[model samples]
Target: MQESHLSAAPQRTGNVIVAVALLVLMAVGGYFRFVGQNWDDFTSLHPDERFLMQVASGIGGPTTLSYTDPAGLTQEQADQRALCYERYPATSGIGGYFDAACSPWNPQNVGFGTFVYGTLPTFSTRAVAEVIAGLSSDQSWLTFYPIHLAARLVSGISELLIILVVFSIGLRLHGKWVGLLAAALYTLTVFSIQQAHFGTSDPMANLFAALSILFAVCVQRDGKLRDYFFFGLAFGCALASRINLLPLVGLIFVASAVRLLPVFARGVAGYEREAHWTQSAVGIILAGVATLVAFRLLNPYAFNGPGIFGLTPNSAWLDEVGKARYFISGEWDAPPNWQWIARPRYLFPLWNMVAYGMGVALGITAVLSTIVALWRLVRGKPGALVNAVPLAWIVAYFGYMGLQWVMTMRYYLPLYPALVVMAAWGLA
Candidate 1:
């Protein structure tokens, strides 16, 4: 008993140290994210953020019993009315949310015929802005400056959450020290800090992506039904924040497969330890159902909506998506396309990521860590396979995005959590 107590004393002390370290890291990271949130000075310098703010400001409940004809209104008046959040009331009820024609909630109804970005971040920001507007009796909260600032706050919070989730991933897979190291590294990442300062959806997308990876680690560790469900939920949220994170779905299959491998190895004997195939199958199905339900709920505008489950495809949204894809593919002749025209596929992105985004030392460490993780997996080292789950996502996502014509640094934000985790593990 004395030996046990003594051993536990050090464990408790270690846990306390870790907790304090994490708090300090979070505070520093929050400062980095929140400090320059007003850097644009109401100028709407970031075009993407400006567009998001416009959509957010425009979304609200129905203003009338029926669609207001825009024909009579001048174009400027129509745009102003579309952007007015105060025009809708709570008394308008849930039905207004699904009304695509004049429901202020719909981006398409906002006179912006094309909204290619994900809806979740915009909706979330608008909801928060409305609450502030109501509480302060300040309608200015619905306008561009205050509202975009609110969005930046949301982004900052999301980045902080990403740090927490990355820490959890490392702790679960490796240890407390690895988790702290990973969180510290991610907190210091320039790309993450920059994204967090913007009002765009990238930080939220990165948050959800990190959350999905954390839950994937949970699934790999325990294969619990809740783990699978939450993994799927996080994945759906990630996708709803940014369609670029669609590749994260592959992590689900990787995690599920890792969970089921032991069952295959032991055959009938594996069933003895609660590693039943039926439970895993059910978990996978539940994951899929949860993902679909979450995606639908968060991105209702993507469907023909009169309610949450409106499953019929929204043709306009689909068309916009296709058009955006075509433009981004560089097949269309556009000003932005010119920069990427002669740029080499993988090298350009790699150079930017190493040189400016992650900094040189950290980037090299991440690469070496990934290679070491792969080698350990090949050698069948203990814990190597679970580590491979994140590596699989890193490789697959990077491969797909690296090949794309759009090689923007923010596009690679989703990979940072896994890379930091791998780097931490390698260092430890």
Candidate 2:
């Protein structure tokens, strides 16, 4: 088996070639698939993609966190508006109404201010690609393909990195075969791959999300500050990419506790590594500082003269976040027999949306695997410790989503890699 062979020895040369080929194929294919839609025209793009592309093209900017409807708005227009939280009530994270200084362009304290100007990383890539293509940066002089190509390149890279991270984690937890299978499943997902093809922050955010969890897994085994540093860097940047990922910060810690508690209680030399308060404290501080610095680098406008904890109401993102939360009322006023995964037929779209894309077979496999894994966990299976991170993260994210009424297929992406692993392993 590949697992035994890979465990017995590292075939560095073959592995690199195969991995590079796969990445190139995925990126190029994803780029072609999107551009094949006549991407040269702005109308063909997704609203968010159009926003980011226009920003990359010239002087257009992203919508503000406080965006309200303009007159004669279509559903598309309203949907395009940013999900600014109600400033009147103030979200749990902040006080008072929205700040005028941060209204249109710099609206987010928790995330980078760039939310107003689209994803800075995508913009930065467009700028660099223009230089490489020898095109003038002047809006009037530049051609569109380079910028469009750059967006695809950046997103595709992000998706590729996500697969690599998933592969690594799967390899670590269950050896080569399961890792490869999980990576393949993650890469094959239409939503995740589609995220890569688009010009949004999601791909980059997914990269960081997968990395944070992968590093969190590493921290479980070793409890190293360096691991925490990496985790912090990724976690901070992931939040910077999208504030919606805030739940993951807590989920990772929960996984750590579930993973480490047994060792501490039993004093098992082989299974346990002591988690020191000093180490954890310093690591957390380092993570926080790193997060601040990273968010600043990604979106510097968030940093006003004296922001609190690197966040000011002017640029903090909590308001928009709160608005997003409140927007979805979870209005499941349907018959009791209604399912949650069947579009209008389902009260909630969470499971329905997932099933629509994950395929019936794979989805069924995931459910069964989750059941077996949980059953084992209930029975105190020793080896189940490593599997706990994915399980806990899926549960945490799902539980959070269960409260949300706005159902997006992409929203479930961060949970994809972990679920894939459990499914594949459980089947075997």
Candidate 3:
């Protein structure tokens, strides 16, 4: 008993050391993410950030509780109260809660017609700004400078969460040392740090993207109902942050398929197969339901106004999304589209990722580790297939985005966590 106790002491000490190291790494990462949040001062030099702030600033609680007839109001008053009747005190009861148009949270009702991105990031930043304004009784927090800072702070917090998620993923895949290494590496990543300093949706979207991957891995490992449910929630949050992350939903199907393999093998061998199919099917269905519910809640304006179901389509929002896609495809003859005219598809993104975004060493290490992981899986190596969840996502996302006309660096933000994990795996 004494020998066993002495042997366990080192292990406990090691765990404490790891815990302390992780905390220190997180502190350093938080400092990098939060610093220089006000880099552009009050000028709002970044066009995307400026537009997002404009939409956020426009979103607020209704000033009046009484419903006013549209016919009695002037054009200005009508515009000011565009969907006022759809929201709270103006349209009270439990019905108002379900009626998205009347909720006062939808950006569409605020009169902005061209909101293309997901609503979660803008809503999150605005919520912070509103709290500050309410507490201080000073509307300055709702102004350009302070609001943008709030957005930046939110973005920073999201990235900080991402670092933690990356660590967890690495720990699951390898062990604590690999997790620590990946977290430290991601903490120092140039692009992540740069994005964290901006008041944009990219970091928030990236956070959800990382989370989806994490939960997908969890489902791959345990094949539990709750894991699938959480994966769906993360996927929905990712979709609500950026529609571009719609591809991440594929991870759910992949995990489900992997979970079914053992059952299929057992059946083929004439063994008594357990009733796992029903469980997996239920999990998948539950995941889908969770995804839709989360998306609807976070992005309420996607539907037409005033109902418990709120299932009717909003044609204006659909049209704006279509236009945004067209512009991104370089078919709109816009100024931003010109940059993609002669740019080679995959090479441009690859070059930027290696040279500027990830730095050459880490990028090369990730590529090599991914190749090694694939090779091991091909050889039927034990535990090698665990990498498939993230590897598949990386391939699918890069394959689709690399072919796109707009090869912006931030478009590849979702790939960072997986890449860092792979890099850490290689080094370990």
Candidate 4:
């Protein structure tokens, strides 16, 4: 017994060693991308920094600044403000591009972060920032870099974990080599690497989504109660990260139900001697409850207090929402719209079709995989849901982006791992 236990220790340690090495390699590759490609984004001071300073000024701070805006202000007032030096019309030289230059110190305008402030509560960054400030009594946003790194690192780690879980699922369903290929393909996929390098919420949310599915798989495999708890935690984390995570969440419950249905019927038919239905039921309930609570906690309104939930006043939200809707629906045109989907927009008659082409390619393959996986499940293949998780992930993600007025491969970075996995599985 002692010798057997000791032998097992080495295998466990080997697994840990391999996982760590893979992560170190991934980190090195991510660092290279960060320095080589995203160096501009990191080195260039955020244009919004000036805007933030202006916001800081109004709360009795010393950084008072002014900007001119012809649309919303009088000619005399617009001329006097330094930030508003160029009127909106003047900047429209290249399809109205040159007309909207604002004064560097103007604080009245809000961009992505501020515009989506109401959605902040459901994000982890604010909570992480609050924790740091409260603990250190430091108010500087620059000091928040550590917090940001921590959050990003968690996202990176989560990607690695997803690889491991996906590999295990593949190994259980197919074989060890298939598992390795799936994990390798996922790790090397272009989209996954890009998302892993960028410090964004999407990668972290994707990690959680992957884990939630993994846990659900375990439950379907008649895994322990602890697996359910973990599924709940991961589900909650995903919800907290992005509202787009809803479809993935819904899929988890549905997948669990679908898998469990046969199991329940089997138990009732005496096909199996005993079935732990109560434990499984409790796990599912726990996952749902945890996800709801996490969604509430991550909401900025919940963190900051009520009334602030909307971030902007009702009027502002309405205006922004209208713009956001238009921008998403393509009713409002953008100068560089649909460029990310395909290079050389001139090659395509309409830029919209370029994105559609990319979407169709990804969507068709995913749909086929889904149909195949479902068929396999009906044929009594174990771990069908587990193997299908990555395909499901990609399909759900593409569906979400399809609703947006604009889509970019970069934005779909989080779903890259799933894509790679699906491709690998299909090829293998």
Maximum-lDDT candidate: 1
Question: Of the candidates numbered 1 and 2, which has the greater TM-score value?
Answer: 1
Error of 3 at 165 (Å): 0.2
Which candidate do you rate higher for lDDT, 3 or 4? Answer: 3
Please write out the lDDT profile of model 4 over residues 243-333, one tens digit for every residue: 4566766555555555556655533655342454555567678777766555444432222122223222234334544654565565665
Candidate 3 off by > 4 Å: 62-103, 266-274
List ranges where model 1 is wrong by over 4 Å: 61-95, 266-275
Off by over 4 Å in 2: 1-42, 56-148, 266-277, 301-303, 306-311, 315-318, 329-350
> What does candidate 2 score on TM?
0.71
How high is the CA lDDT of each candidate model? 0.82, 0.61, 0.82, 0.50
The number of the candidate with the highest TM-score is: 1
Please give, for residues 1-428, the per-residue lDDT of candidate 3 as tens digits: 99999999998998898899889988999999887778876889988999898878766554433222445655644644564433444344112433544444556555455778999999899899988889999888887667998899999999999889999999877888899899989988999999998888999999999999988888877889998899889988998899889999888888777767777763354333445777778888988998988988887667765664767876756876897788688777878788788888888898898888989998888888888987997898988787888888888999989878888899999999998999999899
| lDDT tens digits, residue span 7-36, model 1 | 999999999999999999999999998897
* Model 3 TM-score on a 0 to 1 scale: 0.90
State how far residue 179 of model 3 sits from its true place (Å): 1.1
The stretch of ten residues in a row with the least summed lDDT in candidate 1 is: 61-70
Cα-based lDDT at residue 363, candidate 2? 71
Candidate 3 clash figure, as a count: 2
Compute the lDDT for candidate 3: 0.82
